[model samples]
Target chain A: MSLDPSFVGRTYPPTAPYQVGREKIREFATAIGATDPAYHDPEAARALGHPDVIAPPTFPVVVTMAASRQIIEDPALGVDYSRVVHGDQRFAYTRPVAAGDELVCVNTIEEVTTRGGHGFLTTRTDVSTAAGEQVVAVWSKIVVRGEA
Target chain B: MELPTQTFRVTRADLVRYAGASGDFNPIHWSDRTATKVGLPGVIAHGMFTMALVGRAVTAWAGAPDAVVDFGVRFTRPVVVPDTDEGTEIEVSAVVKEVTEDGLTRLDVTATCLGEKVLSQARATVRMAR
Candidate 1:
């Protein structure tokens, strides 16, 4: 099934604030084998001018994945999640995320198209501090394989 | 200038840990049955996991953990894991594409597994060391 082209430019409501945790950042860094002291020790992070342990560059995906449910699960959109495959990902940061920061995500549908019987959906997530300070912009593209 | 190449091993255990940490419990990353049922060759590494590894390489080249300003990649192929302790390896190398007047360095990165490119159009921009 093809994604509705009209859904392009649709924006979802801001998600509930997610508090970035030091231990979570440590865990993610460990999982990725990022042994930088700034990822594990607050003192090291402080020396680097961060308020707390900073997350890896790709760590925002953890928060955005959950927030994106609003768009992926939209009944009107009629997406078949089982047939989806990731296509592209991009992140532009205003600042690296740090522990104790309260973050929120606003998801917007940037593009929707169909080519070669596959549906291409692109979403842009604006991650920001609860205080409305912009943090990063995350973009993801997923391809819905055609049921041949 | 070309940066030193870095290689990281990817095992099924690593995939399990990444799935838990990243809150992406997609069975295709861990369960072969689910993966095969989904038309995949076998269990596969999450694209985000590969991206994270590339991010590590980029930050290492920039000489800072939080140096990344922009990063992006296209998932051209899956990094298939064959359920072995030996697992697989991803080799990451990059070339300095540009150094901006504002002290940012742009890199064109490449990530490959088993001599096959897994990511395309991979790139990162980082704060150059002062």
Candidate 2:
């Protein structure tokens, strides 16, 4: 089934605040083999001007992915999760996400289209501090393959 | 104009760890049965994981952990990992695309696995470390 273009510009409510933890950042950094000291040591991070341990550039995906469920699970959208393949991802950061920060995501459907009998869904997630400070804007595009 | 190249090894264990860390416990990344059932050759690394590895390379090049200001990539091919101890390898390399007057350095990044490009239109902009 093709994606409904009408879903474009649809915005979801902000997710509950997620407290960033130092252990989570360290785990993610280790999983990706990022050996940077700032990713694990708070002092190293502070030396680089961050308040605490800093997450990698793509770390926001760990949060935005769950936030995006609000859109993909919408019955009106008709997305087949089994057939979804990530197409593109991008991030623009106002600052690094530091451990101990409380973050919330506001999701928006930026585009929807059909090509080659497949559906493409694009979403933009605005991540901000619980206090309303913007941290990053993340964009993701997924292609839902048509059944053979 | 050219930055140093960095290589990362991907293993089944690494995928498992990443899945746990990232909360992306997709069976295709761990279960060979599920992967074959889904038409994938075998277990495949998450595209986000691959992107994160490249992000590491970007920050290393910029010489600071919080240097990245913008980053993007298109997943062109899957980085298929075998069920072996050695798994596979991905090589990440970049060249300076441009340096803005505002202290941002743009890089044209490339990531390849098994000699095939895995990410396209890969680019990053980083704030130079003072």
lDDT of 2 by residue, B59-99 (tens): 88888888999999999999999999999999999999899
Question: What DockQ results do all the predictions give, each relative to the true complex?
Answer: 0.97, 0.95
Clashing pairs in 2: none
> What DockQ would candidate 2 receive versus the native complex?
0.95
Candidate 1 lDDT, A13-102, residue by residue in tens: 999999999999999999999999999999999999999999999999999999999999998987899999999999999999999999
The residue-by-residue lDDT of candidate 2 on A1-148, one tens digit each, is: 5989999998999999989999999999999989899999999999878899999999999999999999989998999999999999999999999999999999999999998899999999999999999999999999999987
Interface RMSD of 1: 0.3
Over 4 Å off in model 1, which ranges? none
Model 1, position A124, has a per-residue lDDT of 100
Worst 10 residues of 2 chain B by lDDT: B59-68
How does residue B118 of candidate 1 score in lDDT?
97
**What is the lDDT, from 0 to 100, of the residue A23 in candidate 1?**
95
What TM-score would each prediction reach against the true structure?
A: 0.99, 0.98
